[model samples]
Target: MTTRVRDERGSAAIEAAIGLPAFVLFVGMIIAGGRLAIAHQSVQAAAADAARAASISRDARTADATARREAEASLANQQIDCRSTRVSVSTAAFRVPVGQAADVTVTVSCRLDLSDLSVPGIPGSRVVRATMSSPIDTWRERAARGFRIPDAYADVWGQS
Candidate 1:
């Protein structure tokens, strides 16, 4: 007598054992991607705020300070706790002659840690960068300020 073969016995359990881990891993990845995306948006907004703050300033000296402060504040407000952060501001536009179009550019970079996921081949953290520019008002008149300018930028004002 030939023995009958079973087609369905233990199949569901076996399949689940193999598939559940994959499904859970997939969901973890989705959540990680979403967190990264939100971080990107937050950094981008921080850059924009930095640029805006810089652009409204009367000179490069003040612009750099304002941009840095704004960018830091924005990141904090967004609840982004970056492992490291760097901010760069270009204030050359402030040197342009009055009545000409110019802009301030701000770039922000932040490293976000994702090591908790332990995804294979993925680094412990990823760096995100965002750059934004804001137009400076051509009609705004800048006044010489009593505040001491940083030595690094003193040459810009013809100061020895």
Candidate 2:
């Protein structure tokens, strides 16, 4: 009587075929996670920059525009390709009287594209948001409210 030997031919090929896809999927997931983390950090930085920029402005209108522009510039500098971006500036602090404590807040939202990763179960895009606030200088001169006497006419108008 002869013992039968099991034929192991093609077993390696089958194992490779099964393992390769799983390996690819794992790598894809890692790449996707890393991308998201970096994007979040970048967005946070953008929000900080925006808040600081807005806080330095003398008026609410200028703060709004400056915050948006600074956020966009920060994202661009970081090479983040956002499909859509929204920058919201809360300048309510601008209403605060001079010589008082106030702060400017900025929120930045960026929609990042993940379709290129082609990772299964991952959304085609994700929105990352960050909010930051910066204190305005307590002694900084802010825009005057209501009617103001012109510098040239201040003497005649008695400095309203």
Candidate 3:
């Protein structure tokens, strides 16, 4: 009985050793996932804000241009490096309503690659992207707003 219990004691230690690294890895993945989720949400908010700004104010691309700046602000609040943020916008020529605006699409993407920044032990970074569609102040249609895309424009579904 003593020999058997002693053998089981070593087995528990061995099991612990084997499980520790895996448990740590799982926890790390969870943390990484959460951080990436936050980044994605920030991008999405920035895109929405930019698109709304563009549509309501007829700012067009200028509105989309604010996405990065606003997103950076959000990341700053989160204490995350947002210097790698990229933002874009696509607007449909079709108006939202007779007296309203057209619709603009805004997209934000970011990759937190700390290799260039030289953070230690973090291994790899993450990439997050978000897109939003906003109404623009065009003179087309509110009730019968036809989806008039520009020659150089494509929706997210169209992008390969």
Candidate 4:
């Protein structure tokens, strides 16, 4: 009877040891998935802000600068897992010099700011990116009304 009781206790201990790890693994995955979803939304918002900034500018250079600032600012304000961001604008006008009627393509990228979250079991630092485009012709007109764009677009001044 003493030997049987000892064996039962050992079996229970072994089962607990195994079960604990599996339970922890499941919970960690759920948390990581939630973090990923938040990061994705932040990236999408940054991208949309960048595109809006670009569309309000008259030329590719101005659009790029405005979009970049907007993307960075958006990410900063959101304060999500997005630690770094870059934005760029490419013109679809197929012209040597981007002009008022140019269609601008905006791209925004963001990545996890956590350093050395180096554990493989946790969320791998992720990069989320998005792109959008809009025409600048209407923006040029709006500017004529003395309506200045936001501060992020300040770099685009006088470049129609």
Candidate 5:
């Protein structure tokens, strides 16, 4: 009985040494997945903000500038740092004729760095992208011509 007990004394230590690394690697993967999910949500929010800002503009030229600024600001507010970032806007719909519905589209992309995970077979970076659209105000004038009050409103315009 004494001889058998001596042989088993160091087995637990040896097993722990062999299993620790695998266990740590599994935990690391879970953390990396969570980080990716956060990045994705941030990108989506940025896209939504960009589209909303652009949709309020009267023309494609101003919409383009507004979208870019809103997207950058949103990402900064969310505290997301990307290895690379891109914001794209599609304004084709804004050129529609008056009385027709129009929409502004914004797309955001970010390359998230995963180097800290130090896991093999996983890319050092991954891309996350989101797209969103917001409708342009149907009644807003598209050009600088502006809008004139209707005959019905003209009588009441100065009464107040």
Candidate 6:
């Protein structure tokens, strides 16, 4: 009687050929997820900064301009290169009278590019948006009022 042995040659190579693509895909997913997370945090921070800047402005016109500038500067500082950006400021609070609680809202939108990652399932670009609100100083004077006083002085003078 004769016995035959099975040949196992090239089995390792076959396994590696199948596994390498899967490993590469997993790494790509991790990179894409990390990039998205960082972008989200950056956008949130930009919105907060913009809202704060707008809240401090004395007039609606100034608030709109200030919010846009602050958002752009904040994103640039973080070294985020956006394909497109949009900053929207809600100045309705500016119309509210002093001594009443009011807040300014700023929305920041950024289009992030991810084509270089070459991730098959992921989109070439993603739009990330964040909205933040900052309370306007209750005692601070508005454009309607001719008087303008610092927040510290407003409290000291019992403006509230």
Candidate whose lDDT is highest:
2
Per-candidate TM vs. native?
A: 0.82, 0.84, 0.63, 0.64, 0.79, 0.83
The Cα local distance difference test for each model comes to 0.88, 0.90, 0.61, 0.67, 0.85, 0.90
Better of 4 and 5 by TM-score: 5
- lDDT tens digits, residues 4-114, model 2? 999999999999999999999898888988878999999999999999999999999999999999999999999998999999999999888778999999999999888
lDDT for residue 88 in candidate 6, whole number 0-100:
91
lDDT of 4 by residue, 23-111 (tens): 98788667767766777787788888888787777555666688888888887788764556666667554242325465667777776
The TM-score obtained by model 1 is 0.82
Candidates' RMSD to native = 7.3, 4.0, 11.0, 9.5, 5.5, 5.6
Off by over 4 Å in 4: 1-10, 81-83, 93-102, 113-124, 135-160
Candidate 6: where is the Cα deviation over 4 Å?
1-4, 116-123, 145-160
Q: What would the per-residue lDDT of candidate 6 be over residues 65-96, giving only the tens digit for each residue?
A: 99999999999999888999999999999888
TM-score of 4: 0.64
- The parts of candidate 3 lying over 4 Å away from their true place are 1-7, 61-68, 91-101, 114-120, 137-160
Candidates 3 and 5, the one with greater TM-score: 5
Give the true-structure RMSD of model 2.
4.0
For each of the candidates, give the backbone clash count.
0, 0, 7, 0, 0, 0
Residues 54-77 of candidate 5: C-alpha lDDT, one tens digit per residue? 999878888899999999999999
Residue pairs in candidate 6 whose N, alpha carbon or C atoms collide under 3 angstroms: none
What value does the lDDT take at residue 142 in candidate 5? 78
Query: Which residue pairs show backbone clashes in model 4?
Result: none
Residue-by-residue lDDT tens digits, candidate 1, 126-149: 899999999999888654445555
Least accurate stretch of 10 residues (summed lDDT) in model 6? 115-124
Task: Write the residue-wise lDDT of candidate 3 on 32-56 in tens digits.
Answer: 6676676667667766776666555
Clashing pairs in 1: none
